[model samples]
Target: MAKKPEPQLPLGSSSTLRGLTESFSFHSSPESFITSRILAFHKEHPDIVDTRAVVRAKVLNRNVAIVSSHAQIQQVLANDAAGYEAGGAYDELMAPFFPSPNLLLTDGGKHEAMRRTWEERMGSLKENVIPLVHQQTTEHFSEPSTSEIDLYDSMKTLSWKILLGTFLGLEHRDKLFETTEGLQENLLRGQFSLFPVTVNTGFWHSPRKKGKEAKRKLQAQTLAHFKEKESACPFATTDDGALEDIANHSVLFTSSLAVKALASILTALVLNLYLYSKEDGRSLAESLASESDPGRRSQRLRSILLETERLSPPIVGVMRRSTRENIIPSTGEQADVKIPKGWDCWLYFVGGGRDPAAFGSTWDAFDPERYINASIPQGAAFGSGPKACLGRELIREIALAMAETCIGLGIRMQGNIAARGVRGWLGWEPNDAVKPADWAQDMKQLPTQRPSEPVMVRVARS
Candidate 1:
């Protein structure tokens, strides 16, 4: 029997397509954009045994590891929690957008302290949160008419309102919304301007300068709101008997990027439902409405949400920085790869979800029943290990409730749906609708996932 040819690592290739098809190329070349480059890289490099798949690369003049294997990615995340603190390229890149030392960029004691405050408030606030989610869902999403909808835009507006009014208890929700509406765009525009190669990294230049200015303005608004003491701030003042923890307030507020994250997930859910239902000769809204038992409906909805998360995660990958030279804990064949200190490790979390070894033969297909019945290894949906996203539960509650509400209201979604972006930043682009100028500008904020073409959907009441 003839042996299969060894796969080549993504190295120098003549054609951009050839580079992406043959090996793992991270940057956007003339032949392809960043989103296509990333997708091609992931699709081709599923297994880690091929050294070419998980090889090292230089990004922004720093040593970097492009990890695709589930075990290797998990090990990197564990290593980060242990010693590889968050400060490095990502910190420098995101500094203009995020405040100094927040949860996303902090490690050790400070992160733990802040996380505790967040968990305490978020966990106990369910009574407050669930009701607010329902209220917001009704207001923004429960309309009973045949109005065309842009799922991405509509969901963002809904999530932002919930975050400000319900989660943060801000009284000036409308004013804050108008002011910070451009927040995501400014951050994305700045990141893109600084690092034209990719949407994730950037330098301290005009784009970043503009993003920082916008961020500072939002932070000031938050500060003034706190000073007024009109409403309680969840993270600012906690009942945990710990310190008054005021320093990380801006970081906490800025973490509303959770809004974008949830919006992406919900968009995927809607698209999947619309496409799949059309295949079975029954509308998703009809099927959902037919289920009279709330418990069964909830379970099915959760399964669909999980499946969407597994098949199409909102964020493509989670990044971590190595604080010191160390041996990354290994799973299979690549245990000996030594990661040098100061190197950035990119965990393709979504790639892990699609790992054939982990999920069996049907890994690529969208099958919610896999989640409902099978015991699949819980891939990094929200994330894995210590630094996993803290707002997973909040996102789940809001997304599930919104899905259930929309279905119950007999809302049917129709349009051309395509996934666009690198990693979990993939946003839905409905091809049938024309792009609006305001919508296009708003999407500039999250170019990584939100496509240049507006995602216009026809939302009709059944």
Candidate 2:
């Protein structure tokens, strides 16, 4: 049997109509950003590369280019070294939470300085952060014993504790978590809100207002913590113009993005382990515990984490904008393309990670061995270039700890995977023989990329 040929984008058709309608608006409905749909679209129309590595369109009244080709996307990210600035329409959507001049907003010298500070501080606290991950994981499972639990909810709570306690150095969870939780919910809602501009206006004004109040409370608490630990924890720098300016930015990053990342990864880990258990007649924990070689065990666990990122990236996409009108040199697929000043660009990571050309024909399969000898393309997970995530190490460590602990506890699915949305945020079971038509239908059914139902799991002592 032969594999089906890749599909081509037809000229003057419904795709163009989708492009027209979608491009006209700067704001993306929560559904529009669903990872599966974008991946399906790119897979369905591989010719986007041949036509132009950059998919040109109008967005937020500006010429927007969605760069899907992995090579071309890397070119755009590295272009930042030449003259491309980081902020864009998506940045505007994030502005309400991250504010201007934060790590994501800054470029060049300022960006370098901030990143350096974070690296030094996080490095100093490695011993603290890793253990904290295990502690939170233990606490979450400690209560339920053998009863079924919602893994999604458990991961979120555990992630919040580690992020708040280990990263930000907050201890008084009673008063602070509520305020932070309020801000986190609003920030999430604002991120996926249909009319993001309305976040701070009229009835929607309440979220923004609540977020502001939360920020104020958080700032005071952070300032106090910094003062108390200033001498002991050199990382909590507040007086200097560098980290202090974006103090609130740190709160949102830890409370929202970090929490979201950890929860998403944990869900992926649980699902993978559950399916593996069913097939192998042993849980991941049992396999891991039986391994005698520490080095091999570490490698295997890390490989699982890497595969999780490849299959279900926590971030759906990475955004960038051109600072000046400049030409992006050609790749094999297309000619050099010019991006006007202020043009917004998106790098679709999910599509790039699953590209058959890049990852071989079984690119969609859940094979951790692919990464043992093979290398993932740059920015395949947390991103690449100057703007890559600074917390990669922290995220990896926490994920490892969570994986080890959950597997050790004999975590397995308790009921049918409870999920919502058309296809749910959690990925479907891997099927190497899935037909293209079935895959497309799955993508179309998804109202939003994120899960709508609780991810339930059970634990038994092995």
For candidate 1, list the clashing residue pairs, or say none: 10-24, 185-445, 314-424, 315-424, 316-423, 316-424
lDDT against the true structure, per candidate, is: 0.59, 0.59
Count the clashes in each prediction: 6, 3
Give per-residue CA lDDT, model 2, range 40-101, as digits (tens). 54677665434224555544444566665556666777645455767555565566555456
* Candidate 2 residue pairs in clash (backbone atoms < 3 Å): 420-453, 425-450, 425-451
Q: What C-alpha lDDT, on a 0 to 100 scale, does residue 353 get in candidate 1?
A: 70
Which regions in candidate 1 have their CA more than 4 angstroms from the true location? Answer: 1-52, 142-147, 170-173, 195-205, 235-256, 328-335, 418-452
**Poorly placed runs, candidate 2 (over 4 Å):** 1-53, 57-62, 79-81, 89-91, 145-147, 171-173, 196-206, 228-246, 277-279, 326-333, 374-379, 410-449
